[model samples]
Target: MTKTVETPREREAALLIKAAASLQNIRDTWPQDFDQLSKALTFNRKLWTIFMSSAAMEDSPLPHQTRQNIVNLGLFILNQTRELTMEPQPQKLDGIININRQIAAGLRAMPA
Candidate 1:
């Protein structure tokens, strides 16, 4: 049988699944060093937020509105991701983690 091509929504869902898997891997392979653990956590949280946002965009009813919202949200997520990747500061990590957790929880509660 020939392989089927994925639509944009399917591709987005695949990406989200990959990101979630990576997050779990990081959690499982937690580093003993405090700095390393912090970095891993920060990176995982950022990926999770992106994944959730992308999934949300996929599930949105109004395609144009969702695209616009994703563009705005994408900018914010990119800025935050940049900050997280830069210095690995506690405050930044905390903020990102909180937002990621909230988004993930909200997304989980949404009907699939």
Candidate 2:
């Protein structure tokens, strides 16, 4: 049997999906797993930071509107991450998961 290597967008989509799953797991555990939740959120924040930086690059191949949208989403994620860190609620992870999953789905649907 042979394994197929994923392309850049596929890899990114997979990461986003994994991040969403992590948040969902944290949500399922509720307030019982602060340590895991914190780590998951930190990972998500780092991922978003990379995405935001990529979107901000002048040489990025993405369309202007797409870049702007990514920036807006990154801002939302940053603010939500801060809120989640401060309040530490299971429900707080929901929006982040949704956004991540949605973006991941979109990326997956794009033509290669």
Give per-residue CA lDDT, model 2, range 5-69, as digits (tens): 99999999999999999999889988677679778988999999999999999999999999999
Q: Give a tens-digit lDDT track for model 1, residues 1-112.
A: 9998765545444544544444344444543333454445555555656644664675656476645765565566557667756654444544444444554555555555
lDDT (Cα, 0-100) at 20 in candidate 1? 44
TM-score of each: 0.45, 0.95
lDDT of each: 0.52, 0.92
C-alpha-based local distance difference test score of model 1: 0.52
